[model samples]
Target: MATQHPNALTRALAELPGPLPAFGVIHIAIPHTSRFTVVGNHLAQHAELSLVAIGIGVHIQSLPVGSLVGIKALTARFAEGEMRIAAALRELEAHGYLRRAHVRLANGRMATRTVFCNQPGALERAGRVVVAPKVPPAVPEEAPAVPEEPPAPPPAPEPDPVPESHPPVRVPPRTAPKPPRRPLPQPRELTPELRRTASAILADLRSHAKELVLSEDDIEELIPGVAAWLEREVRPDAIRHALTADLPKPPKYPAKIVRHRLTVLLPPPLPGAEELAPAAHRPLVIPLQNCDGCDRAFRSREPGRCRGCRDLAAAA
Candidate 1:
């Protein structure tokens, strides 16, 4: 019989490792009545997923698991840093959209495999039974059936002697010890002046850019750098100018952009009194002199005589 050829779509589908469920789209459920409420619920609890999570999620959804994109690549693609990418991934894992497992390979090597599931509970169900790579068991050639002998006698159990008891040995039941409570981290104390300066800088940035949005944590992190800038006598307007200069149209990731600009434009620290001491102690440069006779100006070690004039005077 002539073999029937598979169509293009069928061939493409067959080449895929497994079925593609949603084709290329991820559906986010939006409640008809309480849309904001549902979004706010996620934002409040999963703060790490707030800022760049949607972008990262969309990017990951487009690619297959075990694709060769690294953290650096993701950072470049999202225009954020490795920390942000890592935090977003952690958030995804925490929310059960992503999972990682070390699976044994056919070559006796172990490799980490990442599994992305559209449904949250899929990973949990998958965890119940591990599906490892199947290696075919080596089959030996079938041997001729052997005739078995059926007449073996069973051994009888021995009778127990009376047990001698000392006092009933008291053994305490083992119990797991309670975990020690971790000490709470102390809140970082900022001077009122530093706080005011940082607030002023942040306020100026907001006023200038309007697009820059920084959270309380972001503000706290940026305060020390702004404080240092203030210490160097950098003006507030300069800070604002530095932040908003050359901004992209409809700026994306404003916090990162602002932070990057602020870090890059921070004025170098002023030299200390010790650094100025050598220059201060150096001998002063004497003013240049013109010889009365020659009218030629020269640097005068001794006042008012050029070398020629001095030589002539010495000759006389």
Candidate 2:
């Protein structure tokens, strides 16, 4: 029979020889949707690695830190791409999945630092009650009551004062003020896939030059991926073009009027050759023929009058 050893975290901590550090909660992500912030305090210096071991231990035990997990498991799972993985972290943070670990440093100052996925299980969900505001009950009106006065009494005496001497007093000067705070560091923005998407959109538009009519279904399907890509990777100009191009222009008039009067007028292109007038005499004569009206056979295209005469008549 095989002997089961304690978890890596427990084993590591057991191996530690001296006093632990005065560190506070070390936030970690719980692998699943259980709402909690896992705290692994490393009392000693190298405990962070132990914490990592603990996290794996807890993860293997199926007790994930829930609060740090906002996305579906499939979306939150680790990928090889740094940008994608970072993007997943950002998404989680934006949606309140994970927060910066506010740990108490040994020097007694509180500092917020980053960790990959801090999830604390039971502690994260403790007593978070949403109390609705209460509406006070109405009071009934009543009649006013009469006021009452009071009486007076006797007075008393005084005491003597002593000769006072002054003692040397000391005053202290104010301490120098601390410096101004700098802005928080901004996390990275987008991933390579997003950039690729944006580039693809621009390429597609340039390649397909036509206004590129898309059906509602197509737009709906493509919009999310495009928007995500633009948000993450594309340059401002390219993103602008990708988003605004081919989108419906704002109404010329008020929206109400535009919506009410809007009509989809997809009229056909101007009629084709078959719709134009047929030749006057079926087999059109090249040389002039007789004009039945004046019994003339002119050797010209129009025949009615010679071509020059016909032109002059029309002009006249």
Candidate 3:
């Protein structure tokens, strides 16, 4: 019978010469002596990229030139769905890690060309340090010698107190202008009641999903958008569904997702709604007519027997 080491992990750990790291990653980096790729800390420690994007980016960087990095190819290679891969590729493209453009081939067929950047902004940094070539100084032309004029007496020194009156104006440092904020989508004006209703709907979203909890400020901010949906004859339940349905698992920045959905999925005003409004409220006018059976004036939609005569005839 073969004997096996029951506590293999414990035995292996005990064999280490030094005590284990306090906690966190212990780099057991082996210098690549053969085929390898170098990843910069910029990509490895990106603040905004998802783990999926970072892994996909590293995998792409490791692949040799001429390797297929298309969305379809990547979907086949990774366990992630097509949407996640596409989103990762988009993230890479947006952050200057990748670029894709269609190009016409020699045979007139269109082909997509992709570019990968290991280090973004390197070109801009290099461009900023360009050295201008030195130019030769021009020779001075000979001029007739003239009698030297006496140097003008130095102007009397200006009084310090007078200068202080016109103190050097310290100009504030200029900064880049912030992009204009997009206005909330309000298809129609909201009544006070509508605003209250909208507020209630937003406040109750947390009941369905804990991740959808919104602060008072968020609820206030989103009220107009929800009210706008309500103004379009959209139901409160529908508004809740639009904001909460298909939410990301364990939503991070749930407010941002809600805001995006509010803007993108906003329904248009019901078509011909304005035109049909007056007709619904219009008074129903029935011209006075003499009943043919009773020969008496009665209010009816058309020339028909009065209700009393119809009832009596039915009884008979």
- Tens digits of per-residue lDDT, candidate 2, 4-108, equal 779877765555444443554322211322332223332112223343334332332223222243234423553324554456455444433234555454433
User: What C-alpha lDDT values do all the predictions have?
Assistant: 0.57, 0.37, 0.70
What are the TM-scores, per candidate, against the unseen true structure? 0.28, 0.16, 0.35
Judging by lDDT, tell me the better candidate of 1 and 3.
Answer: 3
TM-score winner: 3
- lDDT by residue (1-316, candidate 3, tens digit) is 8897658566655654565656544323223334545567678878899898999998887665567888899999999999999999999988978865454544334776676766667734643211111111222223233244221223234322111112222212224354455567774677999999999998999998789989999989888888888888899888889888888888888777777788778887777855677886877787898977888899887898988889889999
Please estimate how well model 3 matches the true structure, expressed as its whole-model Cα lDDT: 0.70
Give the per-residue Cα lDDT of candidate 3 at 141: 22
User: Looking at model 3, which ten-residue stretch has the lowest summed lDDT?
Assistant: 128-137
Residue clash pairs of candidate 1: none
Per-candidate alpha-carbon RMSD to the true structure: 26.1, 34.9, 30.6
Per-residue alpha-carbon lDDT of candidate 1 for residues 1-316, written as tens digits (9 for 90 to 100): 9998998766645554433445333222222321111112233334456557655654554453345445777877767889988888887778866566565544334777665444455436644322221112222223233243221222233332222212122112224343343232222455788679777787667677778877777777677767666667677777777778778888878766766566656677678776778876977797788787799998866667788988999999
- Between candidates 1 and 3, the TM-score winner: 3
What local lDDT does model 3 show for residue 174? 28
